[model samples]
Target chain A: MHAFYSPQLTISCREVQLPASESRHALQVLRLGVGDRILLLNGHGIRAEAVLDAVDNRRHSTTTCRILQADAAPQPQPHITLFIAPPKSKNIDAVIRTATELGAAAIVPVLCRFGVAKPDLDTIAHWTKTVIAAAKQSHNPWFPEIKAPAAFADVLEAADDHGFFGAVPEPADALPSPAALPVDDQRQTSLWIGPEGGFAPEELSALLAKGLQPLTVGQWILRVETAVPALLAVVLDRCQPHQRETAE
Target chain B: MHAFYSPQLTISCREVQLPASESRHALQVLRLGVGDRILLLNGHGIRAEAVLDAVDNRRHSTTTCRILQADAAPQPQPHITLFIAPPKSKNIDAVIRTATELGAAAIVPVLCRFGVAKPDLDTIAHWTKTVIAAAKQSHNPWFPEIKAPAAFADVLEAADDHGFFGAVPEPADALPSPAALPVDDQRQTSLWIGPEGGFAPEELSALLAKGLQPLTVGQWILRVETAVPALLAVVLDRCQPHQRETAE
Candidate 1:
């Protein structure tokens, strides 16, 4: 069954009327016909069984999906937020899309001391669309919340509630242990990663002061994009294993 | 300190000259003049401090570097081998490069039952180049070895001596744990990851007959690239927590 993401179903029936973009994909690209079965996710860990009611392939790139029946809801997925010093435009776009597929709950673009890329609100909107589309592709019910690009201090202030930073640490220092971050009750987590040249020395000191962790996956040097997923793999590993095995 | 990789350092050192390609990178791209200091890593994790003596920028892409004084040897880095079903070319590139940065000892391209993209020898060469390039960039003394791509059963005979396979058990069954793998002397370890579509039922059965386990990382549907690094993160987490702590 094909899967779609529609977060609009936060309420009863949790029905998702496929958005124009998704409809185009399902109808035109996938050529999925009406009455065909498909799955819809809200990025909230809910899986809904929806049938294609109508595919208006003309002007409206929307697929009217009728609720057939909802499947047994998955256990609450981990809430992971990413705090990254947004790299160049295309790079950040790639980060958002891939991060969503890997199950990040939110992405906060940070303007760190050494950060080289900072796009305006319009650009952020475009990035937000890219992330939404990715979530839809993965059929992830919970669409990761994309925060408007924020300054370094704002991120620091939010550190206690929904923030954590990632950096390479001194040889003798230890990263936060696996036990340090747990997923017993769905506590939201934010992971911060820096840019190419890395966060400035002062930025490192500031982030460290604000309780950011200089996490390390291994001894080798990793590109910024590689770091995010590698870090998530570590973070996600700490969470309980996958709940239900899906059919291939 | 800047680090470079020089695989040829078995014997002489009176006037150690860096490879031509490295010389160009140091002298041209990085613009390190004579009398400048840098560290050259002889792919076993030994980093030697060298001063630029005669950088005759004779050729555009190749310059010469003569070693200066004391040979500074960093600790020998561990070797991690990833025997993975070659994913798409791009994803394989990601794996080799990222794995190298993450301190993989070597990479063995294994053609498994579900292997989708069968990379030819030329493609294999390209991937090996990627690993080499990543080693230089990550500043790893351990040049991850790229074994010639081979058949799946061939692996049983030559399973890296310290290798482990990542397998998730069928529903209701849990995969065997890493504790099962032998850890005699931390020799080269090969980690096997199935294709994105996962292993064939028959393949899984055959491997089970052997004592080797299809170790499962967790429950989530991890992409091929994601699975290797995540498991490596854990393996790196286990055998080299001391190193991860230091690398941070």
Candidate 2:
């Protein structure tokens, strides 16, 4: 079913207007007309089946829908907050979108010493849109809270005991054992991924000082976009081993 | 350090010529000079440190490098072969690239009942480039074998008992249990993911009849690109829980 983002959607509301962008997409791109049924997402936990009721065509058109039914799903557990240095331009979008699809509870773009991209307000805004589209596409009920790009120092200040960073395994060193991770816990967990060149020594030291442990998926050094989903999958698996078997 | 793909690289080879594409990339894009040091990957398991010795700048310039030292890594275990019905144009590149980065042993493009994008020779050629580039970018010593797109029935016939397909779980059904998967085995494993609409019912039945199991990685219906890496990570984690702790 076609889906649209309607932040104000609620079960009690009889009618709702799709967000301006969503409305334009529905009319111009999807060519959805009145009387068509579509899914409305609130970026919260609301999923409402709504039928297009009115289309006011002018210089700026608006599409309104009547809600038939709505359901709220409790957010998934082990809320994961990802703190990552924004990768280069080509990868930033995929990174954000995939992280959302993987159900990251929040995403914090960090400006690191070795990082390439310094995301601006516009970049953040674009990422917000990417998150919304990803949520609708993946049918994720809960949208991740997207934070403004923060400095590395600021990120370290916010780091807590529940935080961990993806470590590149050393050849002579032992592999990161699964026992090192806290499993079967629903507490909010944080994952910090460094820039392409990786976090500087002082940055690593700072993260470690803040009680962030190191976790490694495997031997191969993966690009930022590749690492995000891979690491998230592993961490999520560890967080709720048995809960993911059934459909949400 | 800059890296290049040299398919014929071996430990005994004293000198090697960079492939035409690599030569152009090193010269035009990367701007590496005659004395620059680089790492050469054979796409098998050979990793060699080499120094550029000569730059034959003719119509098609060829770069010759002197092999300094070489090290060979054994191929990673639980070799995963991905049989995927290609997604739309935008996502296909990411799917192939991320699968290679996740250390898929081979990738087979399958034409499914609900699948879009019937890939031709040109697309296959482009995907081969994508795999090679991903291998080099991810610093993966081993390259995944890329095969020509095949029909669904042909893929089903080639699939073994070790195969599993991602199932969209029913809300009321019990979640997929980890115990259902065969863990800690080094044998080759196969993962088949359908197109955006997923496999038709009869196609699923055919797979089931062929002894392919259904595996669910949580409830979120992921995009093909996102699902590829997420499922690969989970399966790889299960394959050798302890083996991935250290770097190769």
Candidate 3:
């Protein structure tokens, strides 16, 4: 069934009205009409099955849906926070969407010594909308938070979670050996990605002092955008035990 | 250091003439002339530091780089093979490029029940060039083979190694329990990605007989392109330790 996102939804209400945006989507774009069945999911994680009651041409042009069923969503696993140096706008947008789809709990953009792209408040607000849009599309229970920019030092200073830093250093000083892969405790984890030029020598020095695990992703160097998603994929895959069970 | 790829290099000679393509790139595109320093890599896993000895503007330009040092690269572990459901042209190209950067050994285009896109041999040939370009840019030790199109069944029939399938299934057959993560081994591992429409019920049924691992990348559904890189990142990270560690 086609689903829609309407934050203005009320719980236990028999009659639900679509927001103007959703109203236009159902009536004009998707052409859903009275008695047509659809699903509505609020950004807060409520899923509802309903039938369209009517489309109001006036009063913000609401479209009412009669609820057939409503239920609470189950909880997701250990949280993931991306404390990355911002890339260009396009790549950041791609990262936000994919990370949200992949179940990242929060995304915190941090400033690094080599950081190149700096997003303004308007850009940050746009990204927040991207997260909301992605959460809706992926049916995720919670959208990842898009935090304001911060100094790289602040990222390491405030860290208490199991932390990761995407870096390649002298082999001897590399990450805690893979044998010491994080134990499956299901606690929230953090991933830090550098910019196109990657972390400068002194910045890396500071991050390591704060207990950030300097890990290498693969043999080749990945771009800023690719690095973020690749790290998320690897970290989340390692952390989620339920995912491992599927392999026979 | 800037790296350039040339297939015409001979392994034992320790000296090589730039290929026609590299010659043009060196002389014309980059406008480099004699006495400039450059790095040349043989797509066959050898690196040479050479100087631009000479360049001819007329009748097939030529250049030379003397070997400062050379080493054989250790092969990537778990020998990844990406069996991606064919996506739109641009998306497919992006998937191939990103997967190669992530160290996939081969990229096999999969034809599945839910796959809506198909390409001719000419198109496949073009994508092959895309992967080669990506490999050079990433400076990856190995280049991924772009395999011909195969139905999901054919791909599985030819998959002599372990297989993991990405599919959405009912709760009764939810992916293997979380504890069964595959043990890292010095073996090739193959991954199956669903098409945009996803695997049909019957396609997944085929997996049951083959005992294919129906693992989910995570809780949410990823677009076909995102799935390719995300899945590779997770699987390859698990695969590295068990690989035969031949020191480069």
Candidate 4:
């Protein structure tokens, strides 16, 4: 079944109206009419089945649907929070979309010393839209919370959870792999990936002082967009056994 | 030092000439002149430091440089070959780039039943360029060998190594996480990711019949570009200990 984002949808509500944007897509593009079954996602782990009751293609078109069934998906364990410094505008979009699809619980944009692009209000809003679209496309019920861009220091101070920094390994040193990290279900795990030029010396020192372990994805230096998904995948894989144990 | 691709570069060559494309980039774009030091990558694990011997900016421009130092990086262990069904043109680029950055030894585009786009000669050539560029940007000395697009059956027949198929888990079935798979350094690891709609029923059956274990990246359905990196990171993480052991 085709899934559409309906943020206002709730299990308690007998009938739900698709948002204007979704309505236009369903009516004009998908041509979904009365009695057509579709899945509704509310960006809160809710996947509700609904049947279209009314469809209007007017300027203020509204596609209304009656709820048939609703279920909340269990969120992925060891909530992954990605703190990334934005790359170029286009690359940042790829990072956001890929991070969302990879099941990041939250994405926080951090301003780093070597970052090329500074995030603004408009950029943050655009990132949120990208995250939502990614979720809808991936059929992920939960939308990753997109945090406003903040300074590296502020982000470090706020990172109270168990954290790992994705660092490019030095010539002779092999940074610890994520697989070597201990898996703990009780604590949330956060990963911080720096800009293309990497974290400045002071920033690296600060991260080490804050007890964030450095994890290397590979020998090569990965771009911000590449590193985000790469690091998340490794972290998620390391946390899988813990997830299975908790489930049982 | 900045790195440029010099496909003809070798340690024995006292002086090497950069290709016209690299020459334009070095002389015209970067404005590097004679005696400037730069690193050269041969996209086969060779990194040579060289000093510019001659700089020409004409239409058939070629920058000649004398090799100062050379070293070949050891190829990454457990060669990873990715057989992915082509996504949309733009997304396929992202997938190829990320896969290269994550250190896939080779990439093969496979045509799947549900694939959106068919790969042509032009697309294959474009993918090769993307891989080489990604290697340069990521500072990887080795560029992944980009194979011509092949049919699903041909790829399956050639995939005799240990293989994993990225599959969406059935509601009640728990697909093996990539981390849970046993890691062996003796065999190459190949991953097959389907297009957006995923592999058809017969494709899945064929994969299973060929003994490709199904591995799920996450609960959510991810885009091809997103899944490529995510799957690779997990596989690489799982294979890390083995790599270290082999290195030692």
* lDDT per residue (tens digit) for residues A1-248 in model 2: 98888998985888998878889899888888889999988988888999999986663269989999999877876789999998877798888888888889999988889888898889888898889989898888788898988899977786656757877655764433443354434457888999876788888888777777777655677778878888887777656645233211
lDDT tens per residue, model 1, B116-154: 888888997897678767877776767777788888888
Cα lDDT tens digits for candidate 1, A1-248: 67776756543573467877778878888899889888877656666788888778675587888887775445435667788898887677767766876778778888887888887989888987887677665555566788888898877776654345566634554445432343343355567798775677777777767755556777656777678777775665444333111100
Off by over 4 Å in 2: A58-60, A169-180, A243-248, B58-60, B169-180, B184-186, B243-248
Candidate 2 lDDT by residue in tens digits, B1-248: 88899987997999999999899999888888889999899999999999999986663369999999999988887789999998887799988888888888899999998898899999988898998898888788888888889999987886766867877655674433344354433467888898886788888888778767777664577878778888788777656645233211
Better of 1 and 3 by DockQ: 3
Listed models, DockQ each:
0.36, 0.45, 0.47, 0.51
Estimate how well candidate 2 is docked, as a DockQ score. Answer: 0.45
lDDT by residue for model 3 (A24-136), tens: 87787777778899877776667788899887755436898889888766555667788888888888988898888887877888887788887889989999888877776
Q: Give candidate 4 regions above 4 Å deviation.
A: A173-179, A185-187, A242-248, B173-179, B185-187, B242-248
TM-score of 2: 0.91
**Chain B TM-score (each prediction, in order):** 0.81, 0.90, 0.85, 0.91
Q: Which docking class does model 2 fall in?
A: acceptable
Measured by lDDT, the strongest candidate is 4
| Candidate closer to the true structure by TM-score (higher is better), 1 or 4 | 4
Q: Each candidate's fnat, in order?
A: 0.39, 0.47, 0.60, 0.64
Looking at model 3 chain B, report the run of 10 residues with the lowest lDDT sum.
B239-248
lDDT for each residue of candidate 3 in B83-129, tens digit (9 for 90 to 100): 87888887888888898788888888889877877879999899877
